[model samples]
Target: MPTQGLEKSYSREHIARQVQRLGEEISRDYAGEELLVVCVLKGAFLFFADLVRAISLPVNVDFVRVASYGPHTQTTGLVEFRKDLEMSVTGRHVLIIDDILDSGFTLEALYQKLAGRKPESLKTCVLLDKRQARQTAFEADYVGISFDSGFVVGYGLDYQESFRSLADIYLFDPAQSV
Candidate 1:
């Protein structure tokens, strides 16, 4: 695998701290309300697990699998719904958790689909936001980190289905490695 250009971006400790803070904020904002925590599958599996454990509020968990990138560094701009939620979001406070906000197409598509179901309120949370790569105007309600560029892997994020188990985030440049 081309792991030569991998460079550490966010340490595991740093990610844990940020996730804890985000959880506290979420728990405070939704004080007395129950949350339908939806995890965008595959990439968000790890972040979703940690985030839900951090929040103190009552949470119901569900999973949806969507794909825009298939073993590629850039998005294909077409969001494919691989798996649908098993529970209904009608009149419920729904929060979508994703690994990263890059081109925004995948998140936006998912958001719109859920919105059509008439949730009482809908929000988004992403572990990382790459503002410069946005092809749509979608913005996450909660964001852990923001950066302008570079492909990142690890801590639930992956490149070609690899590096997701790494303890920290890393900048990976495929062109510079073999």
Candidate 2:
């Protein structure tokens, strides 16, 4: 695997600190309100778990599996729901948690679909925002960090469904990729 030469980017402490900050921000913003955290599954699971723990407020959690990219490097541009949320978001404060915001198509499609469900309020949060790769009109309400376009793995992000168990994030060397 090209990841044999995986170069560490973000450290575990850095991630924890940012996650705490995001939790505090989210907790303050949603004070005294019923919070429903929608985890954009597979990738955001680890981040979602840590984030919710940092939040002091009571919040419900749900998972939704939406995919725009398969095993390839680029997005297919076609979003599909592999798994849908079981709970009704109606009248609830909804926060969608995603691992990364790349092209914005998946997030935009999800926002529109969730908006149609009549949630009292809907917001988006992302662990990493690659602003340069955006191909659609969208923005994250809360962002943990931002970086230039690069393949990252660890702390919930993955490359071909591996390297997710690493303690910190690593930038994959494209030149090393086969």
Most TM-score-accurate candidate? 1
Q: Across residues 1-178, which tens digit of lDDT does each residue of candidate 2 receive?
A: 3347888889999989989999999999999998999999899999999999998899999999999989877899999989999999999999999999999999999999999999999999998999889999799999998998888888888878888888799998656866
lDDT of 1 by residue, 49-105 (tens): 999999999999999999999879999998999999999999999999999999999
Best-fitting candidate, scored by lDDT = 1
Error of 2 at 1 (Å): 11
Worst lDDT run of 10 residues, candidate 2, spans: 1-10
As for model 2, its CA RMSD to the true structure in angstroms is 1.6
Q: What is the lDDT of residue 87 in candidate 2?
A: 98
Taking all chains together, each candidate's TM-score versus the true structure is 0.96, 0.95
The per-model lDDT (C-alpha) reads: 0.94, 0.91
**TM-score of model 2 vs. true structure:** 0.95
